[model samples]
Each structure stands twice: as C-alpha cells, then as structure tokens.
Target chain A: MSEVILELDAVVKKFDDNEVLKGISLQLHRHEVVCLIGASGSGKSTLLRCVNLLETIDQGTITLFGQSLNDPRIDPDQVRRHTGMVFQSFNLFPHLSVLENVLVGPVRALKRKRSDVVDEAMHLLERIGLSDRAKEFPERLSGGQQQRVAIARSLAMKPALLLLDEVTSALDPSLVGEVLDLLRDLATSGTTMLIATHEMNFARDVAHQVAYLDGGVLVEQGAPDQLFTNPQHDSTRLFLERVR
Target chain B: MSNITDESVSEERPSFFVPRRKQLLVGRRGIVASTLSVVIFLGGLVAVFYLAPGGAAVRRFYFDRHDMWEAFVGNHNAGLSSVGIGIFTNIWVFLVSEVFILIFGLTIAWTRMSKSPVLLPFRILATIYSDIFRGIPVLLVFFLVGFGLPPLGIAVVSYQSVAVYGCVALTLTYSAYVAEVFRAGIYSVPHGQLLAARSLGLTNATTMRRVILPQAVRTVIPPLLNDFISLQKDTALLSLLGVIEAVNAGTIYQDTKFNSSGLVVASLLFLAMTVPLTRFTDGLIARDRKRRLASS
Candidate 1:
C-alpha cells in the first residue's frame, strides 16, 4: 500500500446541541482519490472542513503524514499550507483578476517571487483553458469557468492533499460537466483528493474508495464496484436506490 | 412523436426586435417630462424667491452683489482676509483630519473584529471607545476636546491654534463613525471568503490586508463618502471654535459691512464642495447596483 497522507480516527464534531459528525473514521493514501457520498446535512461537508482544520473536531485525531494535526502545538495555518480546499461557491476574490487569483497563494502566502510564479500560474490557467480570460474578474466568467479558476487557484499551491466540498453542488446542470471533467483529469494525473460530492457516477468512475455516509455515520465503504453492487448496510442500499 | 411533429408545424418564433420609430417615442416622452418639471419646479422656486413681500429688503441684506464680491475678495478697509482664502483653512483641516480618521477608524474596527484571545483586552477597549464616541453628540465631543482637553495641561493636547483643536476634535469624532462603517463593510463580506483565504494558508493579517480589506473598502466607499460629506460640512463648526474658516471670515465681514451677503457667499462655497461629492457617491452606488445586476 502507498503511504497514508491522511488518517481520521473516530473523529467527532458538534454544533451547539447537535452532533454533526458522529465518530467518523476514514483514511486516504498518497495519490489516492476518496469520494464521500452523502445526502445534504449528512456531515459530508463538515467532515471535509474538519480535515482542512477550518472547523475543530470535538474528538479523535486527524493525522496528516504522521503528524497529529489536532495537537495544540500544531499551527493550523501551517497545516493548511500543506492542504488546499475548494469551496462549493467559487469564492474567488472578486477584486482580483483570474490570473491573480491563481497567483495570490504562492506569491503572498508562500512568499514566492511574482516573476517566478507568473509562468507557472499562466500554465495552470492554460490547462484550465482560461488563459484568454486571465485579466477578467471572476464575476465576468460563467459559473463553470469561475469554478475551474477556483480549482486552478488551489492547484497552484501544490498542496499534499486537496479537499473539495461539494464543488459542483452550486453549479448549473449544464456547467457541472465541465468542472467534473476537470476533476476527472486531476484524478487521472494522481492528485490525492478527498471530495464530498452528490454525483454517483462521478464517484464510481474516479474514487479509489467510496464511502457512503448517512446522518453523520459511515454506513458502508469499499471499492466503488463492490459498494454500488452490494452495500453492506440497509441505509446504504436505500440511499443508492433513491439516488439512482 | 406525432405531438412533436404537430407542434413543430404550428409553432411561431418570438420576435425580439422593436421598430426605431417606437424607440424614439421614449426619448420624446423624456423630453416632455423634463420640460414640465423645469416649468413647474424651477419657475415656482424663482417666483417665490423674487416676488415675496420682504424680497427687496431681504435681497439688499443677503444677496447684495457689492457685499458678496467685497466679502469674497476680502474687506480690505476692515483688514479682514478673504472668505475665499479662509476656505483653504477648512480644506486643510478636512484633509488632515480625514487621513487620521481613516487610519484610526480601520485600526479600531480591526481590533473590535479580532477573535484572538490575545486581542481580548484591546477589543474591549475598542468597543468601549466606539460606544462612548458614537453615543455622545459630535458637537459635545468637539466642545470636550476643544475646550476641555487643553486646560488639563497635557503637553501634546495643549495646542494653541483653534484650527489644530478643530482637526483634533473632528478626527476623534469622525473616526468612531467611520470605524462603524468599516466594521459593517467587513461583516458584509461572506464567511466563505475568510474560509477560502485561510485554506490557502494565508495568515489572518495577510488575508485581511490583501483579500478582505480591498473588498471591504470597495463595498464601503459610498457610505464612507457620505461620512466625509458630513465631516466636510462639520468643518464649518470650526467657526464656533474661533478658527478663521470661511464661515468665521464671513462673520467678520458681516460685522464690518453690516450685510449678510458674506454668509451667502460662504454657503455657496460649501454647496459647491459638497454637491459634487454627493453626486459622485450617487453615481458609485448606481454603478455598483448595475454591476451586481449584470453579474447575477
């Protein structure tokens, strides 16, 4: 087996009086793709947020490359530097042009020289097929284009792990295909990713491990063919039935 | 298949074109509306101002052309400076105070918004400061800072010039109001922006300076300008502090020449400064709305 890039051991999270994530455990190896499939409010987004340290977990440890990320001595910002996240809404900095959005992380956060990063940033934009729109603001682009720019912005950081939380959930049906296609290419190129998605077919095609979550509990998880063909849990079968 | 074939045969495509002559009718209606507005509103105002019973006496006292030009050029006989020149003092005070207000306001706002345990004490202090300054009237703050501070024998606070006192007072008061505006702008930014910035490993300070503040400042420009317009007018309050600003200069001329036309000239100068800023702010708001509509 490849080296583990992420390990969640019975991680738990809550909000006020509600338990959003109930002792969920998962793991991803380097160059592996893990797709978390769940209904809305099934704690999929919250689980991804925990891995990124955007939300602190209530219990259990999240280990990243053998480092205990939840340790008090660990700086969340330092941990985040090694991981990149793409939100549901593009959330591109409206004041920045498309090229600047991809450049901001390396130049400002990583302290790379702008001249050194400009070529690589342009290459990333070109890969997304948006080099021509480099000078335009995010709002000027279509929803699919903006989301692709967002993905490119994250990729610019060259993070060890990428967390995508329902990236296509907010996109129009016609636009979802473009973003999913980009993700498919990323998966093929062996970028380690933990994606929370609603698309069953995309999950089956791309994910090395498919985890079905129902109401914050990991109902069943396995290779996509096995999980889809024969879910061990009644809830998992029921979910697949309804979604299909 | 049969229904689709029948529908395709009978379907008529919608026309999006409008005739040029029909479009011209909108321009004609606009012209007529403007003409009616001018005739009713502007003409009515002119008649009321010139045909009133006390019109002659009022004109002689307030709108006398000789007094206006004399006041504008300075009452050389009375050894008073021109109201036009005195306006420069108000402008200087406004410009200096605005710089300080913007810096101090953003600092206080950032301090108040910080969630770090290290900033707790500073946050409390900032909150109290804003609360006290915003709760009291600006005039009272002016009196307190202008009349009350200097007598305490503090070296930095003991400025002799009334204009210096005016600048200090204006900065202290307007900074509080502007701080609230900045805070509102910061909050108006969605939480997702903060998350996105943090996920990129940008430190809080860097995120705020590079990402958050640029967006916040853009969102708050119109309201910030509104505050500045109020601040510019309030510079006239410096006249009460014995600063020889435009209004005070006008008062000196009125005392010497026994006519109020000097005050009219001062009022006109103030309107000239403020109206442009007001219109500019309106244009910004309209453009922002149009941009939002277009994008969404």
Candidate 2:
C-alpha cells in the first residue's frame, strides 16, 4: 500500500483582502515527520490550520486517511476526529484537572465510557511523562508542563494525524528544549505529524522532510539533507541564511 | 486569708481588672452620658409640667383619660388598629406583588444576558420598565396600577387591593434593579474560565450549567439578601394605597383615638424588622470585605 496518508490539492485560502495560501499542494505519507519552516506571516501556521478545517479554505480539497476532509457532503465533525492540533498557547482547560481535560474530548465527544477514558488518559499522560501531574489544574503547571498536558490531551483521542502550530513558541527558552524532546520522541515513534515550527535544529535533525515557505507559497521542499545542505531555490537559500 | 487576699495586690495574680469593673473601661462614657441625658431631660420636663400655666389642668386632662386601653383591647378593629389599619390594608398586596416581581425580574435579567434576538426585546423592555418605574415616584406607580388601570376596564379595587398592587408595582420596579446586580456578578468571571469550557467540546448549555452560573451565583447571594431587606422597608410605601402596614396602623390608631404614643409603637415595629436585617447584612458584608482584603 502507498504510505501517503494526507494530501492537499491546489488549496487556496484568503483572509479578507489578503491571500494567505496561494495554490499550495502537498502530500504527507504515513509515519512521516514534516516541518514547515518560514518567517512570521509567511502562511505556515495558516496552512497547518487549514489541514483540520480550523481555518476554512476558500477552495481546495484535503484528504486524510483515504477520506476527504470537510467535503460538502461529509460531516466536518468526522474530520475533527482524525486530526488534533496543539496550539502554541497550550490551551488546556484551566478549571479542569489535567486528566479531566485530557478525558473531556474523548468521553464527551467520542462517547467513551468514563472508566475506559480514565485508563486511556493515564497511558497518554505517561507517554508525555507527566502522569504524576494528572490531577493538577493547568494554572498549577509551568508553560512547558501545560504544553505537554495539551499534547496528552490531544493524544487521549488517539488521532491518526496531529497538527502542531509552533508548539514551543510560547515556552520559555529553557522549557522549549523539554517539549521539543517530547515532539522528537513522538516523531521517532512513527506518529504522522505536520509541524509549523521555528526551532531550526528540530526541523533539521528530526524532520524526514522540510518545506520552506515564502509569500504564501511553498518555495522548496525535499529530503532534509538536500533542502538543509544544498539550496536549489534562491528564496529557500535566503530564508535559511536569515534563520541560521 | 480570703478576706486579706482581696485587699492585697498580691492576691490571685493581682487580678488586672476586678470582675465587674471591666465594664467601667469600655462602656463608661456611653452609660454615663445616656443616663445623665435622660435624667436631665426628665428633670426639665417635670419643671416644665409643674411650672407651666395649665399644669393642674394638664394633669386633670391627662390623668382622667377615658378607657381607651379597654377600647383598644376589646374592639376587633383594634387588633387591626394596633397593626396600623393602613398597613393591614396593604401588607397582603405588598407580599403578592413582591412574589411576581422576583419571578419576572429574574427572568428579565437572565433574558437580558441571553444571545437570542427575542431576548433583546425583553432586555429593552426591562430597560424601559426599570427606567420608567425608577424615575416616577412609588405613588405614581400605585395610582397607575390601582386607579389608572381600573378606569380602563380593570375593577376599582379597595384600598387594600390598591395597597397590594402598589407593593406589586414597587417589587416589579426594584426586581429589575436586583436583576442588574445578578447580571454584573455573572459577567465578572474571567474569560479563561469560559474558553476552557468551550475547548472541552461542551455545548454552550452545558458550559453555563456546569461551570459559569454556579460560580457567578455565589457572588450574587449576599447582595440579593440585602435587596430583600430593603424590599421589606419599601413595602411601607403600600400605605399610600391604604393597606395598614405598621406605620399606617400607628397613624390610624393615633387618628381614631387621641394618643401620640402609637407613633413610638410604629417606629418600634419598623426597627424590629430592619435592625436584624441590617445587622445580618452588615455581618456578611464585613466577612466578604475581609475576604476581599485578604485576597488583595
């Protein structure tokens, strides 16, 4: 079977008068770790947001797990189930304990039994290495700790594909390393991921492939060795030079 | 030895304050001033009464009074009289009106906060009702409900009915004021609280039920208790339409028979209801203030 699990065909999205995505096309295979590296306002995050229908595309087709996402006939709710996105702000429910926050989307939306959800939540928290902090409120946790809890919250649903929008952007410089390590672990474990990130080293060392974006279009994409080492496109070379 | 110890500083740890003497420090000024004022005022009264031109005539006029006490006790109207006939006429009206006010006020308040377009009309109606009722005097509201409405096919009610309607009118007006208090309490919650609720994938209904209203209602209770207290006193306004609340009862008693002491009795009745309410509200207010201070 072909490894491709997600594909976007000729996607275009505009925000008011400004076009944020300009006819972008890409395919993400199973167990693949892809990083979208670009400067601020370069449409990297918008592209990721479009994948799960967080930001509606003006025109395009998104296919995930052999199913078209957000189709005119398909229920948008179904697409939400297969993909979960973690935001930079680590938007964990503050009034709820970490475990309850993780269990909410599953037990409530997925209609899983409470007992079963609890077991799954513990396992997910353990994977994020914050199993002991499960009963604490989000306010009680550090930024890095909360982000991990957010990851565990999404993981509790056991999504087939995850969207990460600069997950470490809100963390302290010291705390960013620990969350990046967790993301690296998730990638190595063969979880399919599409990350729009600023951590150059993480995008360099861990990404199976890196796509550099500029002016709302994918400028260059290839195996990390080729894209990171030898630049084909002038825009890609200048982007890397600015970052490095 | 006991008698000797009592006289000595060395006795029983030299009791810093001899048991009953503790009162001398805390209440000395109040007791002395109140006692002296009463004595001095009474002394002046006796001098005035004894020295005044019609002193003996005054004594004769006062001492040989009719059997008014017997009339007050034996007459069925007297029970109503002691209640202040005017107040008795309207107390029931006040109570029934207040009940309707609570229901409708809470409804309007909750509606005002709703997102529905239908609720907007209610919100606007509430604003208009509160504005109109609050702007006009209570007497005007009484006239409208009791006298004015009757001419438009509503039956011309008895003073008792008018009084009751008056109470209803007042509560209707004040309940909106009270509802605003509740709305403020609900809105004071931080935004993070709601965002957390939404991201849980909870429907808006469930979010309000589980997380929002409960917390908001906690801050609302103390202020509500205060409004209830004020409502009790405001009920006196019903006397204008002729229900015999305590004040009107005293007025009626004073008018029917010749005695001014009924005024004192009426004051006592109001103080009876208001004092406890004020004390209780003050205690809660104090506790809440302290909590707020400590939190800050």
Highest-lDDT candidate: 1
In model 1, where do residues sit more than 4 Å from their true spots? B1-36, B79-81, B279-296
Backbone clashes per model, in order? Answer: 0, 16
Best by DockQ: 1
Query: Candidate 2 - CAPRI tier?
Result: incorrect
Write candidate 2's Cα lDDT for B1-296 as tens digits.
34564454563455566467546435666688678789999999999999999987755433323323322222464543545343334345545765776677667667777776767877788778767766887667766776765556634453335555666577767777777777787787666455544444455556666567656665776777677666766777766666666666655655766654455555555666667767887787677555533412
lDDT of 2 by residue, A59-85 (tens): 778887777775668654556666777
Q: Tell me the tens digit of each residue's lDDT in model 1 across A1-244.
A: 7999899999999998799999999989999999999899999999989988999999999999999987889988888888999999989998888999999999989999999999999999999999998988788899999999999999999999999999999999999999999999999999999999999999999999999998989888899999999999989999999999
> Candidate 2 chain B: worst 10 consecutive residues by lDDT?
B65-74
Q: Provide TM-scores for the models.
A: 0.92, 0.62
Chain B TM-score list for all models: 0.83, 0.62
